[model samples]
Target chain A: MSQALLTVIGEDRPGIVAAVTQALFTADCSIGDASMMRLGGYFTIMQVIDYPRDLGSVEMALDPAIKRLNLRVHLDPISSVALTADMPNTRVTVYGADHPGIVAGVTGALAAIGFNVIDLESESSGSAERPLYVMVIQGYAPEGVESVRKAVVPLREREGVEIGVHPIEAAVF
Target chain B: MAVLSILTYPDPRLQRKAEPVSVFDDDLHHFIDDLTETMYAGPGGVGIAAPQVDRPQRIVIVDVRPKLGEDCHGLMVLINPELAAWEGMAVGREGCMSVPDFTGNVIRAERIQVQAQDASGRERSYECEGFEARAIQHEMDHLDGFLFLDRLVSRKIDLFRRKQYQK
Candidate 1:
């Protein structure tokens, strides 16, 4: 079996998921892992699919649905790899006044230290006059927790944001 | 006392509702010891329930003191514990030994008053706050066959796979 990664972005509306999944079903592709969410005014979907056919066939199958939904679709062949296990996961949260370089400055610091961002979400709240930006990032840090904290200090100062990095502990019953 | 093996998700036994502990005898004492040993033996474990070890009884052991230091009430052995009063709400990420390999954001009461019987079968009550309250609530859920996954704030965003534990 071959694996493919598909990302669909379009205006927020109902039935987008159903239409996309129906197209994948018609193509005989099975979804492995998927995440769909509404970010501001747009809906975004990221999915990993397993299929017996080639990449072109999967893309062709989704073409009509993509066009009808007025969605932007990006498809690529991906290697079927198992998820990393036993890696330390930390949640890094950054919040402060709305600024243009918050994402880049914060993520750049983490990326420089080889941290892999597994999940991220950000939103701007408050008011137009005094907007606040909040970003929550869940990532795996190979260098451990202290290193991650130390790495973000520069970004914290430069971005003028409150940054907190906490280890995600799972409670054993 | 023995450090019993913790039951993981889909184990069937973890789903079984635990019956209230009525006759607090030698067996009950021994079981509580086992539960305590199991909780301490597990890395970073602050609480545990009898059902996690395949024993369906309303008995749980919580000791956030080791991790929380002077801020906690040391080891808390709650038998047939009940939530008497609760106020406020807060969301905290929780992972369970019985549901290994995953964690989720769970909204629990910020402060709670729990009424329970001690291991000696004496009636007792404790007013706990913060992390202690969260741990107690987490262990208590096991008595009702509820995992942290059931209380997740949002499955779409809050649920996450368990990775390495960082100190």
Candidate 2:
């Protein structure tokens, strides 16, 4: 029994998930946390799995299923390690015209402030000639939201982007 | 008079729509008391709904004065509440006791007017904004089988794994 990280990438289409999960089921693998989504135009699946079979058998099980759909797959063994102990405490959003350095500037501002980003999702839309960029970032800000708000102000001005920071509120109902 | 046990998410009961409260009596008052006690029983809870305790009634008790101050209506017991009007929109981080261990950004009306009835069955209305409105809206969602998770800005972008729910 071993834990492995599996990644699948292919054109977005229906039945992609059903095919992959079925292969895992047939291979007798226990699926862990999985994120299956369409990024840009490609459908991707990232899953952590525990397999009782050998690596070859697991690969063979997935080979036919993914290949038939013209998808690419990779599997790598992973050992548990604590990457960052800080949980997300604030949400930061960025919106501006698409440019070369929006990401670097925004992340640099955050890094300079000692904010550790936990998750980031970004997209660009609008016409090809006038594309708009928007990014949402969640991070651990031990010092709180005001600091995050302040840290981004300089980048917001420099990059000509609108940035907003909100402290994560955990209100019980 | 008694602290009621709140039902957490995936219990199915939390997903059941609550029935409108039609009768106002001593029993209703007692249940409201239990709901209030239960709300206070949780850490920093400012509002609660009857459905959270498996009561399946359109009742909510809210007290935001502790956080928002004198401008708020303070302790409010809203029964059969309905959204009368709302204006503007803003995104705020939200969490819920029902679905603990996660928080997400949820867009809510910046200001809202709510129509409801008090414990005596008399009609009442409240207009509030900011966190007070957010808290009331969060509790009202329970009556309709909605959790704050249902209102997240975006499933892919808003959710951050782990604790703290600003429901």
Candidate 3:
């Protein structure tokens, strides 16, 4: 029932995951949740892993493995305490002609209003006719959606692009 | 007709290629009614395919007009559709009932021309663009036994956290 968070970042290369995961498996660690990505030349990973209840306590066990990987590792033993889960959130996707400061300006406004962003993904597409910048942001309003609605209005006016925000609840199969 | 239970993933029924309608029969009509009812009953579900309702037939109902600002042509029922040709690729995040609890970036054709049959057995061709095209393509993939998961660009780019709503 002990949980730990592991993050791995390095130059994009094969066997990085295999090396890291093999270490976890050898230690009898079970990966509970994880995400890995390749951004240009960098590879990054974030994961939550669980270990046996009596696995050599927290700091003592993870140090040697951290040194061996020659990778930055952070470990925080999860507490049994329960934190109130945040309200379910939604996603908004915006894409149009590319322009400067799109991400900084939009994200700046969002962060100002205390809207917690869960994930934000962006990509560029289109040919010479008009290069496009597309961004999809998944965020939540812990205080409720009214503030989120108000905060985004000015963005729409200044950005000259449409923003679509909908409350999305994950469907359980 | 009543709201039918949506068949989710891990249901072997969703993976099989849907059978084409051979002859117009009462069974076909009944399936259409159920699909319509199920589409409307689900929250924000603008379309439904036969495989979603366990019928394994090539049929779909779509109505995107309700999505604000989308302003798409309303109410289309496509039966036994064939993709003639399509142009352009668009990467967009798509979610499905079958895969519930996940959404991923999928690259799909932005404009498509399809030939299909209507309820009355009339041959019809459609030139669709924008969101309508996306919905049509999503539904048609079901007929071919393909899900949005198969079209994911990369696991790193499109995965998201499941949001919960507060009372």
Candidate 1, chain B, TM-score (2 decimals) = 0.90
**Ranking by DockQ, best first?**
2, 1, 3
TM-score winner: 2
Model 2 chain A scores worst on lDDT over the 10 consecutive residues at A79-88
- Among these predictions, the greatest DockQ belongs to 2
Q: What is the C-alpha lDDT of each candidate?
A: 0.85, 0.84, 0.73
Tell me which of candidates 1 and 2 scores higher on TM-score.
Answer: 2
Q: What's the lDDT for residue B22 in model 2?
A: 92
TM-score of 2: 0.87
lDDT of 2 by residue, A24-94 (tens): 99999989988888899999999999999687888889888777899999999987464557878888888
Per-residue lDDT of candidate 1, residues A59-119 (tens digit)? 8888888888899999888888887555447888888999899999989999998898888
lDDT tens readout by residue for model 1, B3-78: 8998888888887899988898998888888889999997657899899889999998999977778787899899
**lDDT of candidate 3 at residue A10, scale 0 to 100:** 72
Candidate achieving higher lDDT, 2 or 3? 2
Question: What is the descending lDDT order?
Answer: 1, 2, 3
